[model samples]
Target chain A: MSAPAALQVTRADVCCVAAAEAWRGDGEIFASPMGVIPTIGARLARATFEPDLLLSDGEATFVTGTWAVGTPPVGAAEAGIAYRTVFDIAWAGKRHVMMGPVQIDRYGNANISAIGDFFRPTRQLLGVRGAPGNTVNHPTSYWLPRHTRRSFVAAVDVVCGVGYDRAAAAGPSARRFLELRRVVTNLAVLDFATPDHRMRLASVHPGVTVEEVVENTGFELVVEGEVPETPVPVEEKLRLIRVLDPHGARFREVPA
Target chain B: MQVADKRMTAEQVVAELRSGMTIGIGGWGSRRKPMALVRAILRSDLRDLTVVSYGGPDVGLLCAAGKLKRLVYGFVSLDSIPLEPHFQAARQAGTLEVSEWDEGMLQWGLYAAGLRLPFLPTRAGLGSDVMRVNPDLRTVASPYPDGEEVLAVPALHLDAALVHLNRADAAGNAQFLGPDLYFDDLYCMAAERAYVSCERIVSTEELASAGLPTQRVPRWMVHGVVKAPNGAHFTSCAPDYERDEGFQREYVAAAKDPDLWAAFVADYLGGDEEYYQKAVARRPVEVAE
Candidate 1:
């Protein structure tokens, strides 16, 4: 008989784990993920350790349970979320969001608006959805399915989400709840814990080297010591992840 | 007992639209957009329209028709499909003047207009490139000496607002059965005139029997109600029907080429609402492999 292979953990799995780690201390905060991997990560966090993580039904309700991706909400919603309630939660500084930006800079300034000059752009992206409010009101993280030099840029074309530098410029009020925490990418987990608030290499995903991350990133990342491989998802978490994303769209985003 | 007859034909609604007017089109992304009226405006040869919308294909179609002089929007997206390609081409080519706001700011602007307020104080664009890019935007100091300044999001006063809903009474009381009201009512109250196109029109008694939330635009706020079934069409009017993904895909794909786009506009938007419905009914929904 052939030996059973080790748990076939994929890059997406590591990325999800990294993303879930970003929400570790967030207590009873609204968890909003703007993309597929981030959604999986948010769902994974909710189902497992972060039981208090409030998840949206993708329709305007707060739903509990391991709801699968690519499926209409099957379970009963816990509560309704109107536009006013969303603002209430945001203004209370009780939310954490994982957003995907078209371009991100060293200081964590990201852009989801125009690509070229602000007046006349080469490409147009989804205009800033809620980046400003999310960044100014509460904690925020980033998810990058594909980590490349082009995406991790030296400077963003336009700042949609306020970064450390921009927030500081806005004065102390804008910096109150503003925390650019972790950035979970396909290759590695990054954080802005540096003194200068530059992107730092937190942990490289398994099978990826620090040099590879440096080579791919457009700007320098703070590399202090020997980087560790991001922790593999446990069997329970893996099982839950499978149940949460039955269609396997997460794998498609950050393939095995 | 006398009740107002607010019913209107799509063409009648279009007749009210003028060149250089600021209009608001309701619905989030492609959901429940008043596409029938948009088609009417497209056919009317109206130009120099400054549209305010939580945009979708309405923005794309208007841009494709060269009807838009300026766009005041949060974002123009087709949800499942990110950017509306026609809007993309127009903005990129510098053919359209755009004033983009954060989604919340756009909604706030509508709310302020609805309340008849001069401007609303918001933290939405306080410290970002939103200010740097839009130099016309100004800040308002807090009334309290201790309070910090905020961006004074101007009132989005529309000459007319077009919105679509699942159901409405003949007197113009509209109800949205969908999860989100999506600033539609605010758009209605914000405009000088409000036109609602609905999937069906029922009696006020039927509206009450349906037990829709009290969150509805009263008859006093609405000017015209048009019964344009399948009005939202490609845009999803929840509980009525899901978005026609196949048609939406085709529209998005067609927007890339001038020839294909022309053919698409001709095929679907060639005639009035009845012809468009017939075309829609005849075309089979493509089953995903």
Candidate 2:
């Protein structure tokens, strides 16, 4: 793609661009991203390429414009989203969530539940908030600030979100609406477009080597010849991201 | 004739709790939890209780008091503060069993119980570790052969539900001046009894005038009401008050040491709601980071 004149981009900026790319072509959908990085990405997507993406004020109402980080919307919202209405949107599959889990496997089975056994977890993390319904009902992508052997485990200790294998075993009804899309990490952008539904290394971020990604991942990854570097965000998108997140909290998640 | 006043002290309402009974506490995280009722439970000798909640300081206080034998919850977080330290210590020590569910599934269970259904079929726990941790949780096959299997979240019937609202009448009608009701009404209906603690006791007419939109819980659903000022302290009650961040930091920091935690709990846990409030007022507020 041709550059939009005058753009300076960092690796972390590239990662946000990749995260925003996950929701590309998604016209008019609830783009709910959990953590700081994904929140910036969702806002970035709404402000630029995916103007149709809907955002909430992180409280009770929806906002047409991207909100500055650490601040609620100052103007009127597009509409109100109550506790009951949020569930209605999710059950209808009108939502696309970018979740962050503690562990993820080759098949995209993620875990945010606990580290040890189910009965007695040594290190307990957040329980499955909405991962199960989000995965089965609509398209779900993952964003990990740090990617390592521990996070990209051979197998998750607990399966908080159903993977392709588990979804298939659960039957065709389970697989129909299931779309396990991009897995955006600090190191690389991976997806399950392979024949076996394994996570394929889509692109290595700038200055990151394919060898380093392979060394850090616990399970085998699908790496085809000549892995491409993730595309850099144009000047317009970069400027928009800075506005959406004036506090630079996104940098804390994936520092350049 | 004046409506029978259901007003009682927190100690009196908490006395209704028996050993080995299941209870549900309302609020999400550290927001609007019935800390006064929780403190009352701590003061009592209640033991082996099964507590179901979204969880906040209430769970931590109960856990620290050794009152819970089991905790059925989606998560146990303190909002601005991450995990509740006392809950973590209790879990690590294997003192109590836990049935972890998705946040939606827990809500569905309560909804089903409130509606008097055997179970609610939901997609929330279908592929999560919630089922694995809660092995007794079952799934039912869809009637249609092509239909996907859905997890059946059983009804979470409770002996009592303890909640704190911004205002209430002597007759038990409650109003939440906050932005969100946090499913306090569903919890109230899902229980055999619901005891509410409010920041102030207004007349029935005044509660009605607060407007229908703000009336979260109706009179019929509430069995008892306690006038506990600063009832949901240290937790945000919205329009009424914001979270006591400095005190929360102190609570979290104190839990690290047994002697310190014991001393902290002793200072904050006993006495009625007013006594607790005055005690809090006396402490020096730390500067926010």
Candidates' C-alpha lDDT: 0.87, 0.86
TM-scores of chain B alone in all candidate structures, in the order given: 0.97, 0.96
Which residue ranges in model 2 land beyond 4 Å of their true spot?
A1-8, B144-146
In the range A172-193, model 1's lDDT, one tens digit per residue, is 6566667898998999999998
TM-score of each candidate structure, all chains considered together: 0.96, 0.95
lDDT tens readout by residue for model 1, B1-289: 7788999998999898899999999888988899989988988978999999888999999998999999988789998898999889988998998888888888888889999998988777767788887788988877887557778999999999999998998989998888878888899999999999998999888888868584387788899999999999899998898788889999998999889988998899899888899999999867787
Best prediction by DockQ: 1
TM-score of 1: 0.96
For model 2, what is the alpha-carbon lDDT of residue B31? 92
Q: List the residue pairs that clash in candidate 2.
A: none
Query: Model 2, B106: alpha-carbon shift in Å?
Result: 0.8
Error of 2 at A118 (Å): 1.9
- Where model 1 places Cα greater than 4 Å from the true spot, the runs are A1-6, B145-147, B212-215
Compared with the true structure, the alpha-carbon lDDT of candidate 1 equals: 0.87
**Tens-digit lDDT track of model 2 for A131-244:** 777788888999988999999999999888879987877666557678898999999999999998999999999889999999999999999999998988877888987887
